[model samples]
Target: MINTFTKPKRLYQEIGLRLYEELSDSRFSVGDRLPPERDIAERLGVSRAVVREALIMLELMGLVEVRKGSGIYLIKQPTDNSLNNELESTLDNDDVGPFEMMQARQLLESHVAEFAATQATKKDIIKMREALELEKQNIEVLDHNHDADKLFHLAIAEATQNSVLVDLVENLWERRESSPMWKQLHCHITDQTYRKKWLIDHEEILLAIQQKKPDAARMAMWRHLENVKDTLLILSEHKDPSFDGYLFSSNPVQI
Candidate 1:
């Protein structure tokens, strides 16, 4: 017997489809709230990031609504297959704004930085130093090394010693890599000065974490993302009118 059933291509997609089925089957009617992200993640043996991403996808499909500080609720009995079809064919870069992605990162990584600072071991700090050194070296080359930058962030997440937080950081990085919109937006923004500024921000974050200052770590992470959002907004505006649709603010995003 030849078994040909393959797993879903993406973990979040698999989780999203299963969540759709569960929502359809459950007694919870339209307007009823779904389980919390942590609850859902625990029930399914997945990371909170996986659940969060699935929820975002479902919201885009018009199957559910997310009321921040309240909860996620089922808004419609059925989702639009047209949206799904469009997603299958190609994702519209406009569908996800750079501001939106940065907002999500701000929410997750601020807390992650806090936790990593509080819980980081001596070895963890060493690993982070190594990543930082690599980032510095990579930035000098003609071709930028995104992997080194990624490693630095991942090292901070690793310091947390919480599997879920680690997963969330990794998930965010993966999404950034895979997002066409992110690539398009960055193409217009990235330059030597921008890279140098980011490296300095990374160093500030690293210093706070190494010193075991949770508050400082959180603020450092928040400020770094805020700067990133600001720069992206400026570049996005210059590149396309579609980016003007994204809400912009000089004030920092509140998580």
Candidate 2:
């Protein structure tokens, strides 16, 4: 039997689409107040966090209004343009392109580094140093050390004291692992040169944060991601049109 089934969606995304459908069906009229997160969560047999994420998606799509301390309200329908925009976002999550993920990481992590420069304590610095050490050791053993790499970045995000930024950083890293483009791009990195260069880049970022130099930290993080983006592009150039040339072949390299 040839079974055909779509991949399962994340819990929150499934709930988000259900909520959107309810709104589209006019079950919740414009300006009508939606139920509280707790009520919705209980009714749907899901956690409040799931409902909250779903509502956030609606809010982002301009379909709902979240009034502080009041409640969520239906603000508008998902217009054609909004639906198109949300469709693109959904597809990105399913199979985000490596370059798209890199661009998002550069924008978010640069600020995370800057904030960590001012906010990181001695403990955070120690953790970052430990992660960096692990990365070096793993590279020496040809282990790739992806978890340690993530820890180094996540440690900086934690130092920022912003939960949203931390989640954003975590989300980007999670997507990187699932991105087909990213996996294909990494297949070209069989040698240690890139890893060695990245270790030095990580050290520069760590030093800037340790010295509490916000601007330097931001620039260092930016350069690190920029180098990564360039490397991906160059490596992609070497592959056949079927592998990478479809999406990035005609795109100009952006800093």
Top candidate (lDDT): 2
Q: Report the alpha-carbon TM-score of model 1 versus the true structure.
A: 0.59
Candidate 1 lDDT at 37 equals: 67
Question: Residue 27 deviation, candidate 1, in Å?
Answer: 46
lDDT of 1 by residue, 77-170 (tens): 6435564464444332223433466778888898899989999999998888888788778777745767878888888998999888889889
lDDT of each: 0.70, 0.72
Clashing pairs in 1: none
lDDT tens digits, residue span 1-255, model 2: 121223325666667777776776668778888876656777898754356556655665677775543556788875465574664475346654455567778888998999999999999999999999999989888886589989999999999988999999999998888755466446545555687888899999999999999999999999998888766554433332223222223223342
- Deviating ranges (above 4 Å) for candidate 1: 1-96, 239-247, 250-255
Error of 1 at 85 (Å): 8.4
**What's the CA RMSD for each of the models?**
12.7, 16.8
Per-candidate clashes, comma-separated = 0, 0
